[model samples]
Target: MATEDDGVHTICPYCGVGCGLKLKPGEEDGDVSLQPWFDAPVNEGALCIKGGASPQVVNHEDRLTEPLIGDGDGEFRTATWDEALTLIVDELERLAETYGPGATGFFASSKVMNEENYLLQKLARRYGTNNVDNCTRMCHASTVYTLRQSLGAGAMTNSMADLEEHGEVFWVQGANPAEQHVIAHSNYFREATRDGATLIQVDPHANKTTRDADIHLQLEPGTDIPLLNVVLKTIINEELYDETFIEERTTGFDHLEATLEGFDMEEAAERCGVPLADIQEAARIYAEADNAAIFTGMGMSQHTCGVDNVQNEVNLALLTGNLGRPGTGVNPLRGQNNVQGTCDVGAMPNVLPGYLEVDDDEARESVEEVWGFDIPPEPGLTNVEVSNAIGDAIHGLYVMGENPVMSEPDALEVENRLNDLEFLVVQDIFMTETAEFADVVLPATSWAERGGTVTNTDRRVQRMRKVTDVPGNTRHDLEILCEVGTRLFGDGFDFDGPEDVFEELRDVCPIYHGMTYESIGYEGIQWPCYEEGDEGDQYLYQETFDTDDGLGVIRGVRHQDPKEVPDDEFPLVLTTARLEEHYNTGTMSTRSPTLRRKTPENFVDIHPADAEKRGIEDEDYVTLRSRRGEIVLEAHVTEDIKEGVVWTTPHFSDARANTLTNDVLDPLAKIPEYKAAAAEVEPV
Candidate 1:
């Protein structure tokens, strides 16, 4: 039914790697197939299992194809687009006028394109509310907040390509790229390892990524700060730190040194449950290398001390002079494809586009002048805070492409809060667990059926073209956003298409000023493209940092225990992880027949020692209970995890991991302590 010309060039919509993909029409009329783009700079013809199985979800039967309005009695009736939009406008206006703008909140999507996110945030601000946030609050809010505080920028300091080109050593912490970001692992990390770069993995579990590592320091859960502090002390005591770079390019080293003086290597080794020799060796390998990179993940950013953990990571990089150059810098592997772009476009509660604080009068006025609307000076609630504020400070909610009911910590509490909302709207491609609580559900097109730009983890901005038609009566996210915007705020939202929104975005967002769709040909350009015809910088801070003094700041960090520690009642530490076959919340991936067949249900990975202690055998049905709630899943006894720790994936709804995760928030980043929660397991 289609020819060669029908092939659409795009980027993978799964992870932050943002691998280039070629979408071709499949056997069916609207079906599509994915082909890896060899010429692409990021993936280089390599794709993970998730990327290969992406097409299976494009035509899934469960896709939401029509607007549905809930009848008070748990039934949904098909409604016209006009009917749904009118109801939404009326309810939003009623709530805003009755309870004031602060009573309503907007939750943007990290999966959607930059144009859509910009418009969604614009809609919130124009409606006289600053209550806007995204999924980043759940994943990398600490990384962004901490990096901006220490290095003056809140993004990956170096490119993925640099890992292979100039890297001599790699220090991976609290991440399993082999499962989460497979293409990046296969293409860059694997190549770096092959070329003699030493790979040191620091995690609570020995995973597939750690299998190939030169050394695996499998430490205790929630001991990131202590372990890293020991590494810093080793580098300092051995005189392996770059003194000249520290003196010239950084500040606050004196305070950092004072903090390190209090951390004893032997004590830290015992506290972290890792050998002192292993910690010293890993530190030596990193410090002695000519160039090294630090890669972190959600495992480091989802704790009560999340910001401190990232700050220490930054401290390690600054101390070793491993920044602002190829193969060297602090890099955080983002969880979502467009999460970096979503935050960049000002979906955050406290900032405008480009990380400009909303309280800053100049920045507020600049954005106000462009949109002809006064911006809110006060900051709003975060994702976790929004859930807590529902039924009290917040009443109405607008959620786009995010399923907080499944993804948020304490799943039962989130579900209860959603039900308590006076009014709720969910815009997504499928009927998600979160949508079940929505008063109205609007059908939205998937990534394969939409055209927009998404920024990758490496800050590369690439265009995603529409590969096929919308499945049914579903509308593009931009169309839904614009209709809502125009109806709510008179004429500011009248735009031709996504390009018009992007053009307007370029005018306001300094980081995206010089980029155009034409310039971003098949392979997209990285950000900080300040002018036309300028090739974006591959790595940042090569000459000067983005700080006021053009110097990296070393923030003094102290180690702290997790909010909830294991005790006699709950003797094991429970941690959440990802499965290679599934994506976050399992909305799209679980719907795919191929991925579902590969991983049909969730399982708790228990250490053999723990399993034996509990009389739990492999494949045994087990009940895992935490302080908040409990979940029942099959047991997977393995030595991959540590003795006192157990791991599980949060992909299946029947055995929802979030139900048992802790909701304790990090004081700074407001991220839930999803990494380390106290729990007890029993064989059923």
Candidate 2:
């Protein structure tokens, strides 16, 4: 909502910390300025570097002010909205009419509001296709899979505020909150640590979070399952397991016990490249803490064994009575602003709105009754699967605010696959790398020029107010989608605006049913608010799990090697992560002068020992290669990384980390193994 004097309240469009700020028009149109929202919820007026400089991109020199139509050969011409919309509608209709609904795929964006993504998925379904997905598949799909199976929900079990208030120990694995989530670390986690909460960090690279950790376990990449198994073995051997809680609130303990019956913890620690004694010490501290929380990240989720890696974390939490409490449970540090909400609103291939299974007859019928159409019973392709099917099953693509060209693993192949598409349409504020390949591009309004709601990392559904007028001829994402859907089907797309679309979304999404613009005032409401006046839950499963039997399911998982292991040809492990100043794929962050000045280009981090072995010096331009692709970038020889592990970020297009990353996916969640890949390096 707008403040008293021409300022509007909105959430930062960067990370999931959801810092609140106010925006006002400048001396001219398309210019914006930031004002601290002192009474805003979450960050309480705190603005990270990215949040403070977010307005820079609103008036970026590269903003797409009008629609454009390209001739499929790196050439484009300005076009009216009517001409662009008609071209898109005719192409989409022709594709489906000639091939099938399966011939098309939709990519929703985590940077967009929950309401916009909800409408996009609805349009895809109404057009008779289930091939829709978002960036969550690239980051936290495995975490969601394991959590929903074991503990029932697919999000953070406890909010940041509750974790700071009651948590005694913080077991952070595979995540760096200090860099990725600045406000969350500075305001909540750092304060919690200062107040006596023990911080245990487990990662292959020593990041900013490692500096603040009481214990840092720098293990080898792709060894999360083994490391966690060693910890579980230590907990069970010491008789520190919560016997009463396990017997009363959980099941399948025998399965977990039998799997580790003849376990060799020393061997597990050796595989993890850590000492057995240190694992035991960390396990004891975690098991003995009155309240402990586990933070999982891409390190745990972006592997071929991603599902198994996270399930072991669940086994640890359940074995030590960490579930069903205010300060405990396995939490995923979401990478994007609305990643949690994107999945919550059902912008995925296999689920309907509110995570309802598309194949479930009863649930599918309920949604069909509301939309006046029948949804396909079988699930469709995920993001990577859709990419693989570009020349075959998928002939057309519709991308909204997502850049798969830079974000996808083995991006060179994804870049090539775009050329094989019969049609490609991109709706975004700026012309991203992916948008350059589009047959038609729809110019959309910036975040400060749109009004909607976004769900934060902790499940709070907060509202974003429109603070400025849209630029030349640019329309809202919702408006562009409505025009396309109405132009094609001519029904179920007559919504006036985002607020009108949200009302229909509430009827289908049960978790967001109890919320409204008025009810979700300055302080947003958390999900699972089933009815009006409900305060919502700060932590889930206080008494019983959400599983069918009302008991948390305990399972056992063993270590599995990465899809590609370093051999003689490629004798080094390549790990990838993002920096504090950048967001995924460098769409909006690279345009910000503040963020670009801090991190102007991409670079690789190589340990001094490894650099010396290759006769390489610091700041040398290095050519890094994998079996798939190669990129040349500068190097930093430091002790921050392990001896055989080279780390890099995926923010720059010239040296995109995804170009050399493996495309092998986890079996269940289908997430690419971005954390570990067999690679080689040499002087450029």
Candidate 3:
């Protein structure tokens, strides 16, 4: 058993909050428990249920203990590391030689550390393919795309501390932080609300978050743009916008003003299902506050018009001059723990590390010099695009810690496309739904068994120390990737440890240049730390925006209906939500006995009116069918949801919620419409 001196400090691997946790060895071997770290800046000694239970899954019996190679007949047998690596390298080589580098795609993990992600992307790029992406493609790709276009950066403009310290007003839209980011909500957001901040919540349901909101604008599903536009019109008409700030620090005012001409408040209220008075009051509360911030999530970015939704939010912030200051900026609460870091280190198809464009010759040359190799000049396919080009264009895939079958929209289509791949390799701790289709399943170390760093939503890079030895024959992600890269490309994959890979990453990613593990110390450092002895910037854009002219751009956006709308056959709209007790796909969280006892199964939440119409009662089994697929889940009759809408969480494997979600992609972001889908329900 570990003593007090044996405690190891690390960051939580669940959500983007990145709460600090201390692990002490439990009474049993390979078992550890989470202890609160009071000095952590983000959570300040607090942890959510998921974070507290994170250690429960580390030593679970179901963990993949060794590498498995699948035969042509759907049977998998244990294999040595040599056999598995050789098979992977040989298959990758065959695919590349047969169909060129572009035919292979690499899906990185957002759950791992920044160093691991950087190495994964480097390996993929060095192998001569830019078809690399991550789970962020489905979560916040729209937010990144829109924010970068308007403000010249794709990350959160302000720190979480800014909201608690300087925020006078909080506008939360399309997110339930109370359930999703429990520590952040309990420690910072709830504290802000208690401190007399005006909290305005805009969503389609009345849940735990809405209960705490000062004003709830429960609008119609997929009508965020109309309601937001009306608010912008109200602000402009009342002359509440920052005219001086706009004139001096922003551009495109005329174009934005022109787009608001035909936005009738009454029409918007009718379409959005919000009262005109409520809309006007929300606008005044946001515009009149001395300092206000807007927080959005997948609810705003998982639609056909996701980019437009984010662009409108950016315009709102720009018009009010709410950016470039503490407690006043566009903040997107990222879903995964290291999504911000994964993107920052260039796991996407378009950019190299530090948001450098892959197509740019100078950027390509900069990375090429550091790695001593030629890099790909062309931009690659996104996650959704790779799935769409499975059988014909793309043939092989290497997925790390992502369960596309349970997370991606149109589950049946994704499963079929994955099955059609010429060669598939999955590296994860558990035998997930996606792993069932893998030709080679490589066992990987869990968070407690690995030591590395993960960047949180606040852009804070914190270290996660290994608390236990790897179970059985499992290997760390860095070791596996370096070995595979060395075998495939023959050189430049040499690395002593995670810190060595991070040093190489710092050389390529300018944002993380001066940040070292030792420098991070107990309290982590936010990014944009350039030189030694320089502390990182807490909130970005203090003096000027990152744009070419140092001015923010305001883009006018219009409301667009979701790709799949309710019709005669499918009369209700289905949306997805998350459970506080469970994380995405239930890969790790479900293994916890405490979590499972709290939330054992998934259920479709239907309004009392809808449930009554279908003769369905609470706990009654029901069949929910969409054009794509169908599933059976228990019906939860509640008045919290709108009458025509239904909600469910995707954490349960037995009742997969993604089966009924839409796969229509946004033109710019390429994200699926996961929040809105046409469906119908019947009593089972």
True lDDT of residue 415, candidate 3: 91
Task: For residues 1-684, write the lDDT of model 3, one tens digit per residue.
Answer: 212374888888899999988898777657997787777778877988888888888899999999999985578999999999999999999998999989999999899888888988998899898999999998999999998888888999998898888998889989999999888788888899999988899999888898779999998889999999999999999999999889998999888889988778899899999999999999999999889999999899999899999988998999999988888899999888999999999999999999999999998999999999888899999998998899999999999989998889999999989979999999999999999999999999999988888999989988888888889999999999999999998898889999899888889998888988788877788988887666898788878898889989997888899988999999999999888899988999888999999989889889999999889999999999999989999999998899899999989888999999988999999999999999999999
The CA lDDT at 649 in model 2 is 96
CA lDDT of each prediction against the hidden true structure:
0.90, 0.91, 0.90
TM-score of predicted structure 2: 0.99
lDDT of 1 by residue, 1-684 (tens): 212374777888899999877899766645997776777768876888888888887888898999999875568999999999999999999998999988988999989999999999999998888899999999989999999988877899999997788999989998999999998898999888998999999999888898779999999998899899898888888899999889999998898889987678898899999999999999999999999999999999999999999999999999999999999999999988999999999999999988889999999999888888898899888888888999999999999999999999999999888878999999999999999888999999988888899999999999988888887899998999899988987789888888889999988898888999888777788988888887898888988788889999887788889989999999999999898999999999888888999989999999998999999999999999998898899999999989989999988889999999988999998999999999999987
So what's the TM-score on candidate 1? 0.98
Model 2 residue 209 CA deviation (Å) reads 0.3
Worst 10 residues of 2 by lDDT: 1-10
* Distance from true location, Cα of 419 in model 3, Å: 1.5
Candidate 2: misplaced stretches above 4 Å? none
Query: Global CA lDDT of candidate 2, please?
Result: 0.91
Question: lDDT, candidate 1, residue 380?
Answer: 85
Residue-level error in angstroms, candidate 1, position 260: 1.8
